[model samples]
Target: METASMSLLHALKEVLSEQQVTENQTVRELHGRDESYHKESLPDLVVFPETAQQVSEIVKLANKYEVPIVPFGLGSSLEGHVIPYEHGITIDFSLMNKILEVRESDFLVRVQPGVTRTQLNKELKKYGLFFSVDPGADATLGGMAATNASGTTSVKYGVMRDQVRDLEVVLADGSIIHTGNLAAKSSSGYHLNGLFVGSEGTLGCFTELTLNVYGIPEHVMAARASFPSLNDAVEAVVSILQAGVPIARVELVDEPSMKQVNLFSETSYKERPTLFLEFHGNEAGLKQDVEFTREIVEDHHCLDIEFETDNAARNRLWEARHNLAYAFIHGHPGKKMMVTDVCLPISELSGAISHAREAVDLLGLPGGIVGHVGDGNYHTLLMIDMSNQDEIEKAEKFNEQIVLYALERGGTCTGEHGVGVGKQKYQQKEHGQALHVMENIKLALDPDNLFNPNKILKTKDRG
Candidate 1:
């Protein structure tokens, strides 16, 4: 470590308990990389702070010494959002995991940055409420908000940004601020909560968050529908949304992914393009919606559709869909998983997914296409052999082709995954002059470029 780096390290040690500070190689390695295949850069030291004040103190010390600091949760980010590329200190929030408050009547929950969605849901079960934004990873709430994550449930309950009601943030100059209030609706100030939630730690570190929750639905139903082709599956979802089916969740799984799901999950689900559908409401209302959804799918030439009202059966259905990524990882022992996320308009989703399948085939890569088609967002999961540079290049080229296709048709390069180095290049093309405004915000909030350096905007003086 350099003199300044070592000095900052010593300062951090003095500020916190000795057990909270460590330069252990094993711990640093664990903090080095997230779930992404992006190259790892280990941190010089790791620190555990159990309170927002401690996080504030750490931020002050980092700014004082001109050292970079990155906030880490469970390291579940897929685009390298948690990786400490600048080799500074990592503030792992695992130790701070706690449910701060559950305002049951208000349908809101206040939690520390470390609480995971499943963990919160388990607690909310007692109150007959649930936190709804599940990104399929049991990811930390702070990590989810940083990436503005969404999943199958997002088609109904909405994404992380929509759930966040307030944020207790520690800024670059050690000043703590709240971006929003406890009210359900407000036009009082600038949408700071909106700006900070998806800023990917470039703005500041979120210590505590107040979020919206929902009461458990009176009736819940899930189904799986198999289609002959990918376009048919996507078109069915679009039609379902168009016909006002009020779907709680609608996910598309291509035939190739369905095969992987069967192989890994040990279930004989039809190895064809499939749609996972769900409805949440009172029993009578759900019955009407289910019938309407069935008619819509049959109109689009669905091969076979089955519905499950049993809770265990519904759980099994989603568990397989959520495990698709791990299925690929388990099947390919030595390879890495790169999932390309792109979202387009509902009118263009069918074409976009078809183009994605052709690109994967044209590149001769082993990949699967799946998505939350209810919201016009989809992903191409590419399994790459890391040792083979040629395969890696092909996978990257496949991503570029799909991204360009989405951009050309009024879609985003990434739907849920934030611009964590992987999607930074397209920020200019996507945002154009608006990119300059983001850079200005970065420079104004963190002029030293120390907060999660080289993420999102790739700001001034970051070279």
Candidate 2:
């Protein structure tokens, strides 16, 4: 019998058009990994499917061969979800990218999985609508759904899961299925939409998505507020959320992260713990919200507050925050960005973050803490020399300690970044009995475990 890789490659070439397949090392290397903590291992092949039919065929072939099929997007995932650990096929969705339909009346847009968030937003702007799941990078919609990603705007607009109204998925056995209808809020069948949204490609591959879009607010404003201490800045976010200011974005930048932003973005942001905020509404409502937020921030001992009412200034403010991860990468010439994501309850956020900061400081690690504070989610992006075993161990320990703290506080090991291979160890600890149910679901959907094998749910050892 032919090897899994050879057989799957042959089947893919036979079914797909000439443009849909490649075994080029350069291209395979590019799709082999994501922006992650894990090391790279190239996939045996790369298949670019342009339509749902094509995707279904590719998955069917892989399933038949009992080979792992890792779905590739923009390669922006912080976890190793896209990495083909079992080394079979990397399905690249870039060719399938297209805006299928835009329903202005219904506030929804149907798009192929490969379309990036920025790409979708650019087209939507003509209709006065925008996709709200901005993960800083222009990540593909399919990757966003796979990771159930949330970002700066998530506190108000909800995560990728919440934005998706429907999904066209290609299951492990190469059967195509629609997860949801256009109608919002359905008590319909088993909530398949929710299951696939964050499934991380373990059960099926998303070929297309009908996502919820938002209208451009009549008024929008951004502000940057500084505090003497990081905890004070964190406290202000808690206060703002509790007061219900309807903040669109509330991001916390530590002094170190602020320094990196200032240096990389060529902006003179004060090197202090700061909260960058955005408010959206009608003119009168936005003004009221800003005023209310100011009062709350001042009460928390805010050192200074600056608001950006103009488009250019507001864009600059958000650009600095969004470009933070890149800033770290740019600042450290040869270092990799190893970030930890742990989310806790609002009440415990400050404690969790404080402990994380102490962990970094105590270990003398070069890292910075920034957070989606309104939602009690934070990340510590550590710039480390990958060659140094000591530094790598420190990064791993920091992640372990922070995750344990969050788990103890009714929080998860990862807030937005899904449990790819990197976070699998924490799954049982976080979910316990729920994990058993997840395993059962995994078995039901892809008993062969060929879809994104060794990710999210690892069953190789059990088998």
Candidate 3:
């Protein structure tokens, strides 16, 4: 007997407008990939639902038909989270791009899933407010929340979870629920909002998000400090943080990364391991921070200090830092960028970075290290030919080794990036019995494992 889900294409054609559903091979193929280094999996169908009500109804149909539903946004995920490997429905949120409310007085903004960070920032500029969780991509706010993403600004502003005030979720059973309240602080029941924010769409579908916003800083300055050695730069960052310099954005890019940026971004920065830093505050406060930061960097045997005080120069400096990922991508066309992230305590950062550099050298991979050093979180972007089996094996071992290094030093397997499929194998080792507790909660919230199944938790095969 044919399952109800087997007839979903026909049912969807009957209920949804033509523009809302499509089984076109091109569309399905487009929806089936993310920015991961993994192989792609095309969904059997792609659906675009425009509202929370529509999402709930579609999920209800999916539940009744026992069809898997994968939520998709900008497809900017570095992990394989957005791929519908089970070949069911992929719900695209492009049509849901609506900014529902801009509560400037409350310093909060409510927006639908499809609104991208750049789009929302452009809109927020008029109000003298901005959202802070930037993952270098103009990714959708829902996607950012799903991954708990962070970028250069995360050192001071925190990640996606820190900004999320509430989430409007569509459960696996087609029930609609709100995960949190509008208040700034809450001692409420279960912290469902926190749970769902980093759930990577495995727990429920996020249709709308209320996020905290910040008033634009009055003054901003960017600086680049190059060290003779990577350890000197690492120690400088530790001292800056320990001394409470109030540095807004402190990023570390190693010598090879700097060289890549020079070639890709067309700017001649020193071809040595460097720290790109930013300070934000009142002019007086910023000046004080700059002086203090310079003293610390110099004390750590700093080689040079270049500060950009003009707004245009400051913007350009950050643009270079933000474009580092793009630089790698542009420099290595046809090769996939296999990026890995691990965060260590400040005390262990220098050692970990040294270990990472050694591994990269031994593996003979064309990769570079850059990170939000203030938080001791870093990423290594490897340019690899996916078809090369030996290269692929080296990448996997390198990732495992780095993760093991971090875990042994009381750090996490992943810092900002959630445990999408790529890091799921390490879940047990990282979380231990806490992993079971997470699985139990998953069972309670999504008993059938219908919502983003095989993501954060494993389950029996529906087949």
TM-score, one value per model: 0.98, 0.97, 0.98
42-104: candidate 2 lDDT, tens digit per residue: 888888888899888887787677668888898988888888877878889999899999999
lDDT of 1 by residue, 8-125 (tens): 8789888899989898999999999999989999999899999999999999998887778899999988888888888888999998889999999999999998999989999999
Candidate 3 per-residue C-alpha lDDT over 433-454 given as tens digits, one digit per residue, 9 for 90 to 100: 9999998988887787777778
Best by TM-score: 1
> C-alpha displacement of 409 in model 3, angstroms?
0.9
Question: What's the lDDT for candidate 1?
Answer: 0.90
Which pairs of residues collide in model 2? none
The clash numbers for all candidates, in the given order, read 0, 0, 0
- lDDT preference between candidates 1 and 3, better one: 1
User: Which residue pairs show collisions in model 1?
Assistant: none
